[model samples]
Target: MRWSIPRSDAVDVLREQLRKQVRAPFAATAGMVVLLWASLTPSLMPRTALFQALLTALCMLAGYGAGALAGWLVRSCGGRLAGRARVIAWRVLAGVAGIGTLIVLGLSLRWENEVRDLVGVDRVGIWHLVLTVLITAVLLALLLGLSRGIRALGRSIGRFVGRFLPAAASTVIGGLIAAVLIYELAIGVGGNRLLGALDSSFATINQEFRTEIPAPTTPELTASPASSQAWEDLGRQGRVFIASAPTAADIGEFTQEPAQQPVRAYVGAGHEGVDIREEASAAVTELDALGGFDRAVINVVTGTGRGWVNENQAQALEFMWGGDTATVSLQYSYLPSWMSFVLDRQRAQDAGLALFDAVYGRWLEIPEAERPLLVVSGESLGSFGGEAAFSGAQDLATRTDGALFVGPTADNRLWSRFTEEREPGTPQVLPILDDGEIVRFADQPEQWDLPGAWEGTRIGYLQHANDPITWWSPSLALECPDWLEEERGRDVSPNVRWIPGVTMLQLGVDQFSANSVPQGQGHQFGTAPVYAWAEILPPPGWSDERTDELAVVIGDRAWLR
Candidate 1:
């Protein structure tokens, strides 16, 4: 101790700081190894030497500062107080190091708002964060426990070693133990963090594939003609994005006919539905809130590009495109459901009568007073079921009351022709999310056209202007000059439909993205307003005067809550 000299010279300062840096990291590493071995570290550490250095340095700084203070306080306290103070000090220091480990884990995971205030906007990859947290926790817990053990064992070691040898030998033994701890710490770090960090950070991250999606590959969004003009590539409305493919064909089983009686309809047996058969992608997503119905059926789903009926709680019907690990893009929802193919009109008639008899037994044969209200609704396939349900309800001697048809190219035309007229109900659309906040989108009429199929019928349209998914193409909206500036019936609300809710949910929110190219705006990115049914626009970004028929944010702050 007398031989050692303390100096404040620049050279000395650098030397001391360097030594602390070097030794502290080794100390920290040794602590971590022991902690990890003890199953007490908080998170998994990066397998790089640089990451190890950073971790070791932090732990060392915290541990040493606490240890020095404790040593000082103990010297002053002189006895039992010193021993207790030492324990308390180590506990506090180790606890802090453990917390630091958690913070590191948050960084690794990259979810900025996980703690909201602590981290912002960095969505850490889920697995990495989890792994890091687990490892760090194990490390920290082990360190704390080891510190306690060290305190307990140090005195015992001193007494036993001192009795066996000369006092000098005891000093040698203590030094050897300290050296072994220090050596273990020095060897544990894996070191790539420090190396790669020397190069450009962005380069490293890009090369790592740890940030951002790779460049574009979709033909619909490449150097082709489609990329030349401004076109919505994929449109995501809520959880659904119905991007009209170049290969779009009449996937609907029914054919379209002109509207009659203000709301024309078509009727087909078993699978005759599509009234306004236009093609884009159509789908339905039953999310958290929409899980209200146990037996749920979504008509004209934008994602599946087909009608879905969930009879029992099982997967919906789908077009078969075989593969393992289906890309959500190509086959969004490929469900399995029962379907009967009627090869000819005669088959439909035969099945219709026989099916009617069976359905009649359950629907009509049951006491009319005992039956519950039936909900009949559909676009294409949905319309077929609606018709059968309506007919079945009639067979049961209970008149089918409320019926709504969407994209009714067939059913609406026929249903309107059959129904006897009564006083037309004034359209009752509700905007519950706001007081008087109105969202105006171009291609969407002033009053916003409700599906024409609603005329002379109790129809409810869950629409946001021209939903391209149900065939109201952006091309149609664009062609209809002053589609926005026109009166309600002439352009927007066409006399028979209503909106029960204003705010609509994003189908697959943050998940909405398109394969992008290097060229600016070449992204036929699946933007909601730009392509899909629910042209969802974010809060107050698009103004009143601007009308692109794009989704505009219309609700109040409370809607978020």
Candidate 2:
């Protein structure tokens, strides 16, 4: 028979539990401190005044929010259990890190196209991601638990005391002040009312990013979109679309020997996609020099004084992805002189449009209306030029009676926006996979990852396995944005084995570094990540067991094996 304990005794037992919970984190605290110290790589330069001020302001506002979360946690979980929570958190973080390491290893080890296709490997394998999450949770939990223990021990909270608060409150207050200042004093600068005064802030914030390019010999640098198209149109029949992207040396980095190139890629071992940063107008000049294609889809190769460059090339190809294997590209021949962080992007988009248009016009001249339509598609930007080119093809397909859309970010807005501009329900927009399978960041902020009617259309999301730009967003990751359960064809979530190439999105960015600076330090994140072709694709039709010898052999370095 057990004797009943007094209320004081019960309280003491509860206290002991809390005390133990609190101690676990404390025990790990020294390890965490050592780990953090080892991982510490401070910024080379001093924090800017604005960054400092903002940080301070953020710290102030966060105080309240942190207090609230802390109170809530303590109340809900019983403060004594905090140590256990922290331990669990650390364990989770360790798990995630382990997973990430494994993913990296798997991707480098057992890689192939069919594996990429059927098993669904991406840049970071799912296991790797699991590890990363575990690591993050574990690290954070360890910190939290240690803090709780320290506080219970009557120690000072230190700088981190501010982190738990509501960060947005201070930001809102600061933004209001800044907005008021701009409106009153900076009116003329903001005159374009179209691109509000706030636009410059984004530019200024992004200006610190750096990209190293070899100095051009010609001071009079030019980027003619039409001209660029003419120069590159020569590669359509069998010219692999080697990455036109230039490295710091300002030279096309095609794989050395062609046949030994990677599968599903243009250039050789150095990586397939190009990173040319010429002027927006360069393609026009190149096209003019080359004498252009005749009949095209959206933009005529030789426009009878007809239209601007178009998006037909990509549209036509995507129109027939599995119909007949074809490679497409948007590149610049001569690096442009008028290059900036921003203009590099615009020119690439324009040049690509011109090339596609030229390609389309060539198709038109075939005069064989009986040609079984090859699938056509292209990735567009979140801006005007890409929208125009994409919309042009979309419109034409509707008129012609056949077209399809693929890629991570399909144009769902094309329906509502295009309809509003023209007649209601005038243009036909058929998203083979409803707006749900895989949504892009540029498409719609609200509908990301939401479920839609599942249709088992044979769809392929060519997500370059480890293209950093396409993955690991601080904002989107929290949402569980893509579908977890497969509704249609095989689950196409890329992993270590399966890899997506970065040719398309890389074209849209100006400088590779320009796209990567927000999250990472320098601009290294902007460049496209590579994978092996033989490694990424499903067993191509050409091969029996191994990847098609000729294709994978030739395209060897084109992708990462």
TM-score leader: 2
Off by over 4 Å in 1: 1-361, 379-381, 384-398, 404-461, 469-485, 488-561
Looking at candidate 1, what is the lDDT of residue 241?
19
The TM-scores of all predictions, comma-separated, are 0.21, 0.32
What does candidate 2's lDDT look like per residue over 1-561, in tens digits?
999999999999999998876443322433333233212111111122222223222222233234444544555565643578867866875775467545543443233223333323232234533453345445455556644443443212222332553544443444445445556554444444423332343223222212242212221111223122222222221122222211222111222212111111111111122333222233333323333221122211211000111222221221212212233333332222112112334443454355445445544555576332322333322122223345543354432322222122222234224322432322121122334232122111121233454222211222221222323223332332222112222222233111111112212221232223231122121111111122112222423233233322223333210
Q: Indicate the residue-level lDDT of 204 in model 1.
A: 24
Q: Give the Cα-based TM-score of candidate 1 against the true structure.
A: 0.21
Candidate 2: where is the Cα deviation over 4 Å? Answer: 1-282, 294-388, 392-482, 485-561
How many backbone clashes does every candidate have? 71, 109
The residue-by-residue lDDT of candidate 1 on 301-386, one tens digit each, is 21112222211101111101000000111111111111111111122223222322332343444465654333233332233333
